[model samples]
Target: MTTATLPARSDLGRPIILLMAVACGVIVANLYYAQTLIDVIGPQIGMSASVAGLITTLTQLGYGLGLFLIVPVADLFENRRIVLGSILVTVIGCLAIAASQGPTSFLVASILTGVGATGAQVLVPLASHLAAPEKQGRVVGTVMSGLLFGIMLARPVANFLAGSFGWRSTFLVSAAAMALIGIALLLACPQRRPRGGMRYGEALASTFAQLRQHRVVRMRAFYQSLMFAAFNLFWTAAPLALIRQFHLGHAGVGAFALAGAGGALVAPVAGWLADRRLTRPTSLAGLAGLSVGFLLADWTVAAGSLIGFTIMAVLIDAAVQLSQITGQKLIFSIDPDARGRINAAYMTVMFVVGALGSVIGSATYEAGGWSASAIAGAAIGGVATLGFLLFDRGASAPR
Candidate 1:
């Protein structure tokens, strides 16, 4: 299908994409805010860096649980209500964090925040359902752009706020924003309820059964998990390295993170490529780039050169975003009816891997220094790159 023959904007227009994107961005951003504020929050609550990392770990863990368990409800019930409820839950979580007196409250709040922020996975599938077939890639891409922006920008924004005000203020502001957006979505979006009903057990059984039966889904999920494992490794160590090794302050480290956002801006271009039937090649290319980037980043970090590290940051992040878009495009192609469930399963696995990677990154960095962690991460990416190549062999050829 060519652009000339593409469906009308009414079927998948700028407005719809924009709204979906904003929703996705807002929801997804909630997950990463803790990353930026944790440095500040840790001292305030008397937590160590490793324990602080667990806050993110638990949030990710909660997100994984919510994705597999809660998101499936989108398939059984009306998404508008589910989404509204999720956002409300997020608001509550954020408020809890804002008002917390200690690390325990923050940890619980983080888990709830993760549970509530899963609205993005549901909304992405909803966009795919609403879009014309030929436009699914672009439509998904547009919404993902927002999601990527949220992921990429969350830390920087939180860092900015935390630096300017306090860590608690970040959650208070986020809570208010989530509440406002939840209200707006309730009023503005049209109802999209599930037409078919299935018992909770049936939904769980079917979701797993579908995963077992679908070769494409399994391969895409596996490949994405491996890729994200390495992605999280870098992010987990980035601030620690900057602040400890380079002697940069939180604000400076946050700026370094903001620079990484450059890579996510390519999300739309990745979508266009996938839509034009270049998804497989794009995936392979992205994986290869990520592997190479990891090696370069490892070298830069080991050498203690800020300029080299900065360039590596851009290349590595861009490569990660490209792989992410490619992975989602593949999953989105497999089944529309269960996109949310599929994504939930995929993300649950990946988040688990990511949490493990964060621990690995921190431990490696602390033990053997940046060189050891960077090299290990690069090696992991290389292994995943091989999977990307092999995975493409059995799939439909890219357009």
Candidate 2:
């Protein structure tokens, strides 16, 4: 694929973009639905506390694996078909989870859900492909805002559903929702077949090649990995902290999660900045905000002020979302033809680190409680801030 083969202008009107955004929200929500339900699902399914923590970790692990293995195939096949196929897998996974009777079955279903949820990744790069170069940042940002909101809201929605109807009902409803979204997307999404002539094997091989060849891809991926690790660490631990320290029930946790969704409002702003070629400065601010948010969270927790803690949650989520969009806009600009593979490489690394962050959050919470988790999160943010200042200070924006 070459520049000449690309569309002269974006075909992504507001309607299609809105549809893509909603689809992304529904698709990505699968990977997170179980996070807040761990306590409810684990006990009913006979899982011990220690093993229950693997619920979130395994889902993320499956997603990371799909990013490495399944996402690259987007470059070798019709993008819409791939997304629809992945959604079918998601439907099956959700049904299996709904029917699960034991820990083994439940965990396995969780993995499948995560793998199938890679459909969101497919839609993102597809959005980039359809948008004109100048509008790519704004379009991707808008779509990602949907995805981020899905992530932020999944916890509360899952909690609310579980509290009202039981955890199994949550999975059942998700399966039905996915099926409907898949049918609508199949009817509406424009078919985009990659012009690259690479075979599937070649496409997978080229992901590694892209990592080596594109310095911006590497830098952006590394920067976001650090921020994303902190993002996961905080979310994973925050619920536990609320339950243990504040005596919040599932409903209370759900309300807290809803408050965090406010941070997703930053996605379009970050995208706007990226379109204006302010990636470096915006990214630095995002990193600094992450550290400051965690520090404020630490203070709020110590003061036992829920309002202050919620405010910090908004800041933390906003900062992480900002950095994410900035990195994505930068990477998407590097190669139009390889957006699938580029996204695969970038997201694979970030989510892999994110999975570790979940595990670390659990372990640290068990070891030293909320203070430890906050400190660990702040330290991760500080590392990212230093990396940006020292190594990526003068990085050039993609033209």
What's model 2's TM-score?
0.93
**Candidate 1 structure quality by residue, lDDT tens digits, 118-222:** 888888777766677667677777788788778878988887788789877888888888877777777665556555456776776677665687776677766
User: In terms of TM-score, which candidate is strongest?
Assistant: 2
Pairs in steric clash, model 2: none
Write one digit per residue (lDDT tens) for candidate 2, span 212-256.
998888888887888888988998899898898889987888888
The lDDT values for all models are: 0.76, 0.86
Instruction: Output the TM-score of candidate 1.
Output: 0.90
TM-score for each prediction?
0.90, 0.93
Clash-forming residue pairs, model 1: 277-399
Model 1 misplaced regions, further than 4 Å: 1-9, 42-54, 102-104, 302-305, 396-399
> Per-residue error at 164 for model 1, in Å?
2.5
163: Cα error in model 1, Å: 2.8
